[model samples]
Every structure is written in structure tokens, then in C-alpha cells.
Target: MIRPGLTVKLSLLLACIGVIASGATGYYAYRANRNMLVNEAELSLLTSTELLGQRFSTSIDDVGADALVLASLPSTAEVAQSDDGLRRNSAREQLANVYSSFMVHHPEYLQIRLITREHHGLELVRFDRDADGLVRVKGDNLQEKGQFAYVFDTLTFSPGRIYTSPIAVNHEYGTHAAEGKPTLRLGTPVSNAQGAVVGVVVIDIDLEGLFKRLQNDLPSDYRVYLANEWGDFLVHPDASKAFGFDRGRRVLMQDSFSVTKPLFAQVQSEVRVNGLARPKQAAGQVLAFVRRPFGDSEGNRFIVIGLAKPLDDVLSGATLLGNRIVRMVLVFSVLALFLAILFARALTKPLHSLAYAATHLFAGHAMETLPLDRTDEIGLLARCFDRLRREIRLQMDALHTKQRELAHLATHDALTELPNRVLFLEKLERAIEEATQRQEGLAVLFVDLDRFKQINDQFGHAIGDKVLVAVARRLKQVLSSADVVARLGGDEFIVLIEGQRSADGASAIAARVVNALNEELSVDGQSMTVGASIGISQFPDDSGTAEELLLNADAAMYAAKADGRSAYLRYHDVLEARRREQAEQAERARAGEGATAGREAEPTA
Candidate 1:
């Protein structure tokens, strides 16, 4: 190979440097965006999984409550007890009619039976809902189920106590729709007049039906997975994978999702995994798993519920970003090569330093550092560069000022002139940190406007917007200047009260807010009457984190609405009601844990 000239070598070196810089910057940018997308997908999946688990728990609790209700009825005990002739027959008929009504209302209930404790667990009344309609199995058809766990296990419990059977495929002979379907059995012992465990009332819940309703609102791209405590798959995306144990083979969740081993080991209650991080296992998928307790204080039983989405779906935005980055790198590389060739050819002995200074001047060197004293052609060029730098600095300053203005607009609401959700959350986080350091208390008030949607639909959004602005103003006027009042979005506002404040103090603030918004507002000659429901939650009292605090406050706000509009409720009161409900279940649940009622927030105006 012929040795190249100094100019050619220098040009090649400069060109290679420029290409590497562009390629490295593009690569890092692409990676950062990809990682961010994956992280957000993981968080979203986890939230969906948690919500689904809560729903499943709630459904199971409802079924258990129904079983208890039937057991408590006097007619069930009369039918189950050993009695003479017409009276027992009439009681059986009455109870059967009730079971039929339940079947009609809940298509998911495959069978409801009242089994006697005296006749070796003989079925006294039974109603089954098959494909055609509700069928009451009578006479010889009502078989004895003394050996089954749902009967024998339930009869051992005291009155009001619920027995939850393990999930399994129903294989009992003469069963209607429940036969061959995955079923969950809930049973409660029926007591006589003297409060003795005389019989058991059982309800067979179709597992597939319960899950179908729970997953109805989820996105179509989502895949649901469920497994027992033993890691055996009960429900999977692939039908063949589900109930594999019944088919004489075993398909385990932990075996498929290696990251889920921690869940089986009881090391972690929740796990999030993405295919991009580990392509060999969950290839092209992002998954979240949560371990939820399945039974009412029985056997310490739990189930793993998971949701998965396609990696391609989650990374769609990142893919677009990567393509843009690739184009930018290519253009920069070509431009750098052309400029390197020209610079190499033009640089002479004296001009080389000048060229180097020109290249680095924009990189953050002072224009005064250039050789302006030399009265030559190079000096003239240096002076020109100095002048150009000054002009660019002024333009940069103006650009920075514009950027700050845009940032303010992004964080604050244009309609209300108050902090928006994004800014409010940031401030809440900072306040929480300060409160924790100072060992002080803080509170968050979640305010929701009642009847705002009706007004918006009747009049127009313009008037509704005016009402929102008015509401925001009144909220600010009601709260002290030290407190932060923010409009979270249409018909909803949030307040952050920092410093030491008792629950009573927060309630006082909430009451003032409710009264303020409850007043009639005349917006553009239209008299609009709006009421406020405020929920208050305190830091370190209701929750320690910002997200939990907001959620608690939101829950309390709904309770206020439920009590009656234009009222305020503390988050502590919501917890108190839940505590009372759970206390009632304490007799039935050994763990003293039961389903807490949930309320949905109203749609934004």
C-alpha cells in the first residue's frame, strides 16, 4: 500500500472521529428510550394485575357471603332438619324456589345445594343451571355427598364460618353444567334454632365464568395466567397448557416463567419481567405476577395471577424513536465526512491552530481566547468568529427564556391557572419528604364536583369550563395561602396541606371546601349549582407515600359522595367502615381478613 499524504491521513482521522461520536450518541439515545418504554410497560402491567386480583377476591367474597345468607335462613334449617311429612316438604319446596331464583340471577352458579348433617350429608334441596335452564334435582336424583370435602369439611365448621374448597374440575356423577368444568366450592354451616351446626349450604362457582367477567375490561392484547399455590396452571392463554394435571401431565408456571420462582418460594409477593431483559424465557412478552390469598383464613392458600402483553406492542413508540435516531446518525456522519475533507485541505501551518480554535469555540471556549491582536487575514477571521459567537449567545438566551415559559405552561392548567396533576404530584412528593424529615404531619384533600357532568351535557362545555374555573377560585379562597390548591382536571381538584395538622383540622379544611363549591356560581348569566365531595387523608396516618395518599383521599371523596353530596369525609372514616366490615367477618375468617368494598371514581367533566 502506498503511504498516504499528511492531509489525507488527517482527513481520514477526523472523519472517523466524527462518525464514532455520532454513532455512539445515537446508540445511547436509542437504548435510553427503549429502557424507559420497558419500565413504563412493566408498571402498567403490574397495576392491571393488582386490579384484576382485587376483583377476583371481591367476587369470591360475594359468593361466600351468599352461601352464608342461605345458611342463615330459617327455611334452609327447617328443610335440612329431620321433620315429619308435609311441613318438611313445604320447607324443601320453599328453599328450592329460592335456589332457583339465585341460579336465574347468577348464570355463573352451576349448582346450589343444602345438604343434611343427619342423613350422612344427603342433599335435601338442590338446584342446577344447565344449558337449557334451571333444573331442580329431586327424589333419587339428590345423592349423598358425605365423603366430599365441600360437605364433610363444611359440616365441621361452626355457624357463620365459611369453608373454601380447593379449585378442581367437577367430576361428580349426575351433576349438570358443573360437571367437567373448573369449579370453586364455597360452603357455610347451617345452624338450628339452638345455634347448632345442623347442615351445610354450598354453592358451586364456575371458575371460568368468574374470570371472564374480571378480564372483560382488559385490553385484547393482554393474556391472563393463573396458577394454584403449587404452581399448577389453572388458567393459561393456551387451553392445552391449562389443567394439564388433569390430562396426566404437569405444566407449571414456575417452569415456564423462571423469574416467577420467587413467588413460589414466597420470597416476593409480586414479580415483573420483560422479554427484552431475558429473551430466552418470556420472549417478546412483558409479564407481571401477583400472589393473592385465595381462601378465607384457610390453609394459608394463595394463587398467582399474572398479565402479559406483547413486547412489540409496548415498544412501538421506542421503535419509532430508534428509526429517527438511525436517520440522524447517518446524516451527521455524511456531513462530518464532507466538512473534514474541506478542513484538512484548507489548514496550513499558521491556520491549523486557528481552525482548531474555530472548531472548539462552539464547544464552550471563550471568543476572547482567539488571536484578535494579530492584524492579518487570520486575525480578521478570528474577529468575525467572535462577533458571530456574541450573536449566537443572545439568541441562545432568548431560546432559554422561551423554554422556561413552555415548561411553566406544561406544568400548570391554562383554564384554571393552577398547578396541574404533573406539578401537583411533584410538589406532593417533595412535601412528603420534608414532612418525614421534620416528623410533621401533612394531608391531601381530594375534591370532586357533583352534578358537573349533568350541567356540562345540559348547557355546554364552555359553561362547564367556566364553572370549573370558578370552583378552582373558590377552593383557593377557602384554603390558606400556605396550603397548595391544584386543579387535577375537569371537576376534580386536590389540595396539599403541609405542617402539623390533626385529622380534625383536615376535616375543617375539607368542610370549608365542600361548602365553598356547594354555593351557586353565576357563570356568564347562567346560574349553575354545583356540590363538592371532599376526601381528606393525612400523611403517616392514612399512608406514607404520595400515590397511596392520593388513592386514599380519592376513596374518601367517593364515600362523601355516597353519604350525600356537599359533604366531606376523612380517609380515616373510609378505613373505619372497612375495619368494621372486616371485624364482622372475623368470626368466619381466622386471619381476620375479608374483602373491603370498593368504589369507582366519577368520570371527569
Candidate 2:
């Protein structure tokens, strides 16, 4: 017969084995579920990204097509044939009509303008409504003679063809605007009936409005970002100042064009590595990235579109099954322990009198009468509980620590030891709500390093990281305890300043920050000067909600960069009008050039 102690030890060992097996199964199932969920999320995001990218491309194409149509208008040709003074007037009327039609049909378009080939000056024919519901026109010339000299020179140098340039802030306009305002200029050679090259027609567009429309297309939980070939954040949903392309007062190409040399090389390898296509049915998790060539040449830049999803969400049901099994095992183990304790108590009672006699005999230094006891289940249970209590106490402490560590790692940034984006945004929303209710002002500023990429490209990322750390130190020193500052990622930082009295008060803080950051930072015995362009938007005044406030602030920040770096700008109505005008001019130029050659040839025939 098994002794009570042996019976108890055997039961404990069996329970431990069962628990361990259950835990292993549960862990495997949890991991599988997590992977599936991640895969699903990534896939969803990827699909959305592709759909959005297609939409964006389609919109751009539409703008181009519309531009082509406007350029072919008889009124545009008449303006081209007329003298300079009459041409300007005719161009104005034609531009107004085009702008009205385009805006009415495609509210995504901001404005339209026409540029002449000879003078290369810009004229503002269409003024779009600003944030405050005011319509404003660009005071610059149509040909961009004095202003947009680069744009004019590029068009003039390459005449009778359509050219697309990066979105740039028109400093001449002096307003804060975001980048990615795609300007499509079509330079058509105005020719006589004999087909001689004469003047050129131009069209410009503001893609910012299109971006806004596209953003609305995305789900609330998902974020849509438009990066240049380079990894710079072009259009981030978060109006956090950390977004935008500013390179030491000059804007760096942050779109797909900004990929690292090595990364680009790898991308090239993937493109040419093999002709083999991806499999139709892949298992587990899959990250699909497609590199499509931009422009009409082999050497054109490639746009990398990636789609990812979590494997866990996809297999949550499987995980639930595992969890239930583990729970059942735990319940059984607890029931067994309780029954063992009751049996142990019942069996020990008979021994209690014997134990008391033995204790008295030991105290008196005399032999005690031995009570004969038979081996039974109750005695075995008492021994089992004794063993379980000892083992459980030993393991519980270590398990708790491990669990806490895991929780910490999930919420904190490994590099900075600070709360990550998830935590920061959570707090930010709460802060915004509290401030809004109190009728206090709150400001969100998105701060981006002027030329952080250049530093990384020139000195390597190690040095670049060092520079970032130093900058972060300075940022912490500048802000108040109440203010929330977070590194969204890379060289971008977001500052949420609460309890402001007015919008100007927030502006003043932004100015102070710009000034503070304007100083030279010494890194690795080399001193480099970088400036910041801050976009400030106040609560209630700029937006009623946190998301809208952030967007307005972000738009204003882009405006600052567009106006000129090392400055700050608040959201204003006039900025939108100017953006529309720029977009319209670029569109007209594209359409006019295509039709000009054909029209000129017809007259000659």
C-alpha cells in the first residue's frame, strides 16, 4: 500500500505534469493566434495602402487629363495668338472659367493658372477660398518670372512637354502649406498656322486638397502616410510637427525618392533577382511588397508598396480553444487540491490524539503509547497538500516578475526607455479632452529635423542617432513639465502644450522653440546648425476635436516650410486659396502643350 506521503507526492507530480502540458499547448496556441492576427492586420493595411495609392494615382491622372482639355480650349489658343496685354486679359478670363469648372466638378482641385512661354511670369486668375472662407489670389506672375524661377527655367529648358515636379512651398506666397502639392506643368509651344514654335501654355494644381479627400477615405484606426522615395514622412495623419521634409532650410525629397543607397540597392536586387512571381497561396504570415517603376523609363525610381497583417487575429478562435483547455486543467487541479485537503483533515483527526500523547511523552522524556493507523486516502491527501504548498510558494515569485517585465516591454520604447506612441497618444487624447472642457487652449506642434537625413547619409546612422539623442535632450530641457513631448519616430517629435490662453500664446511657444533650435548643435566634435519649422493650431479656434486640431496644425506647419523655414504659422483661410491657384496653373500647362502641336500642324495643312 502507498504511504500517505507517497500518495500526496504522486498526486502533486501528476498535477504539475498536467499543468505544464496545458501551459505549453496554450502558449503555442496563443503564439499562433497572435501571428495570425498580425498577418491579418498587415494584409488589411496593405490592401488599403494599395487602394489608396491607386486612388491617388487616378486623381493625379484625372488632373492631368483635365489640364490637357483646358489647354486645348479655343479661348486659350486665342490668348496665345493675342499681344501680351490682350493675352493676359484673355488668359485671365479663360483661367477663371477653367478654375470654376474644375472646382465645381472636382472640389479636390484648389485653383488653376496659365503661364506664357515668353515672359515666364505668373498671374493669379483663380483664387480659392481660404480656411476663413475668404477667396484669395496669388500675386505672383503667370510665367513665374521673378518667382518660381526654378519651375520656369525647367519648363523653358524642356519645352513642348509635360513635366511634374516635387511639391514645394511657394515662399513668394508667404503662407504655411503642406508638401506633396503636386504641380503639373505642361509647356506647349504656341505655333503659327505654319507650325513654328511660339509661346507655351502652363497649368498648376494644389494636391493638398486631394490628400485631404484621400485621408477621409481611410478608416479611423488605420493611418495613411505618403513618404517620398526617401523615408521622410510626407503626409502623416498625425499633425505632429515631426512630419514634413526640411533640410537645413531646404526641403529634402522625403517621398519614395529618399530611400537609402543600400536599401535602394536591395530593392533593385529584388526587382531583378528573379522572374519568378509570388505564390498564390502562402501559409502562416506573409508580407507582400511590390516595387513599381515610376516615370516612363527603366532608370526611373521605384515605389515600394508593402502589405502586412498579423497571424493572431486570423486564428483567435483556435487560441480560444487552447485557453479553455488550460482553464479546465486549472479548475481540475484546484478541485483535486481542495478534496485532498478535506480528506487529509479527516484522516489526521484520528492521529491528533496519538500526536498529543507523543508530544507529551517527548516533553516528559518518557516513551509514549503508539496509536496504530492504517494507510488511507485521507492520509495521502495531507502529504500531497504539504508538497504542493512548498513548490507553489517557490515558483510564484519568479513568475510574477517575468509577467511584469513582459508588460513593461510592451508599453515602453526600448531605445529611450520612455512611453511609446501608444501610451503618448493615449495621454494626449485625455489631455486634449480635459483642456477642451475647461475652455483652455491646447497646441500640437510637429517638429522635424531640418537635414537629419543628410547627416545620416554623410556621416552614417550611428552619428545620426547620436545627434537625435542630443536633440531630444535639448527638447526635454525646453518644454515644461505639463507639456507632453514624444518622438513619434525617426527625427520627428511631437509637442502637445496645454493650458494656453490664446492661439498667439501657442505661437509664442513655437517661436521660442524655433529660436532655441536655431542654435548650432555640436555632435562628435562637429557643429551643425539646424532650424525647425513649427506648425501651430489651437484647440477650439482651429478645431473642435483633437484630430482636426492636429491636422490644422500640421497644415499650418507645412505652410511655414512652404513660406520659408525657421518660422511658424497659424492656420488661416487665405492659405487654401493660394494652394488652389497654384494647382490650377500647373494643370493648365499640361493640357495646353499636348494640343498646341496638333493645332499648329492643322493650320499649316
lDDT of 1 by residue, 1-605 (tens): 98997688778888989999999999998888888999898999999999999888888889988998898888888878873222348777877888888888888898999998876788888888788988888777778889998898888898988898888899999888888999889999999999888889999999999899889999999999999888989999999999888889989999999889999898899999899998887899999999987657755667899999999999899889989999999999999899888887877455564766677666546565778887988788888888787788899999999999999899999999999999999999999899889899899999998989999999899888888888888888888999998888878899999886544488888878777787889999988789888888899989999999999999999998999988988888888998998987876675333332222223331
Clashes of each: 0, 86
RMSD vs true structure, all candidates: 16.3, 25.2
For model 2, residues 225-327, the per-residue Cα lDDT tens digits are 4444544444544444213544333222222223223334444422111011222232333333333333213224334443333233345576686668678
TM-score of each: 0.56, 0.41
lDDT of 1: 0.86
Best by lDDT: 1
